[model samples]
Target: MSKQVIALAYDGRNAPSVTAKGDDALAEAILAIAREHEVPIYENAELVRLLARLELGDAIPEALYRSIAEVIAFAWYLKGKAPVGFGQRDDGDAPLLLSGPER
Candidate 1:
């Protein structure tokens, strides 16, 4: 069976956003979108720290570009999908993207 692949986006500060694709197609689509928008992408703990300091409705800081990228990339990896751009999802898949290292 084909596993549901997903794509994720975020404001680089708040929670992650997610989307679904049939397979790796979603991940590729996400990369393309990021490239088109000239947005950097990232993955790992650095992403978490950067996202932590952001507040909803606050303006995105210029310095946080890399961090935002990392968060988006990480979200993709976590969901076994790809980075799309900047948005969030609330479906069952949402938890997977929002999940961080178990503390």
Candidate 2:
């Protein structure tokens, strides 16, 4: 399969949107920009195949909510960020489960 890359952006209040997508050389450029910006990179060939189907500026479909959420959550964890009010109260002491890197 040819190399591919997809980039997404999400605001807490709205669904995530596809900000970029490309194959081969364009894919390399996208990855380079992301690396320059220090954005987290997660590699999943299967997920890339699915996301590459989306148009630029398109919000992620409902069917992908869970998968996308997991990726976003992991990125947040890597950046040491938590959702607003998450684990803020004494009663909400749930620990975030960070797992081994996915291949």
Candidate 3:
């Protein structure tokens, strides 16, 4: 399978931003860094594709809040960290961001 990885950074101040993205070699490199740094990595092809469409450093769009929130929640669970509210909840529902080691 081809390697597809997208890196996101959420500081609880602004919307989450896509920080990096790559395929093949660069994708492998991204995974390597995550492994070395103990960053939680979640493999979601659909999500990766959506995130890949974002320009590096662009905050995720509103339409993606719910989906991305879910990803963050899962990552937090995996790393044993609590999921925290992310920015604002458009639907007036609970939204969470993943918290873990450096993203």
Candidate 4:
């Protein structure tokens, strides 16, 4: 069976960072790796909005750039086979119960 993938959104002051849904760290790492590889990145809605507020040819703020970088890194890590939940089946099956009982 295919695995369930989620879409992640980053809520920062400037750009609203969006990434492929996956483990937080993994996704960020993926984005970072992509950046390191010199891949072009696109801006999400939030980022566009923020950029729109600036004058043409204006430089982005440092804080906002840092936030964008972090979110991008996360997106990079998601490209690999990273598991979402703990103790769950890797094949996209439900987790097996080790112990269960009614209270």
**RMSD for each of the candidates:** 13.3, 7.1, 7.9, 17.8
Which lDDT tens digits does candidate 3 get at residues 17-76? 877777777778877787787777776677777777788889899999998877876766
RMSD of 1: 13.3
Q: List the residue pairs that clash in candidate 1.
A: 9-87, 10-86, 17-87, 17-88, 41-69, 42-69, 42-70, 43-70
Candidate 4 minimal-lDDT segment of 10 residues:
94-103
Total clashes for model 1: 8
Candidate models: Cα lDDT each: 0.42, 0.70, 0.67, 0.37
Q: Which regions of candidate 4 are displaced past 4 Å?
A: 1-43, 71-103
Q: Write the per-residue lDDT of candidate 4 for residues 1-103, one digit (tens) a residue.
A: 1112222233323343233332345445545664675444453545444443444234445657765455444544443322445443343311110111111
What is the TM-score of each predicted model, taking all chains together? 0.32, 0.81, 0.75, 0.27
Could you say which candidate leads in TM-score? 2
- Evaluated at residue 28, the lDDT of candidate 1 is 55
Worst 10 residues of 3 by lDDT: 92-101
Count clashing residue pairs per candidate: 8, 0, 0, 16
Give candidate 1's whole-model lDDT.
Answer: 0.42
lDDT of 4: 0.37
lDDT for each residue of candidate 1 in 1-103, tens digit (9 for 90 to 100): 2222223445434644443222245445545665575444443343444444545334336676565455545545655554344354432322222222322
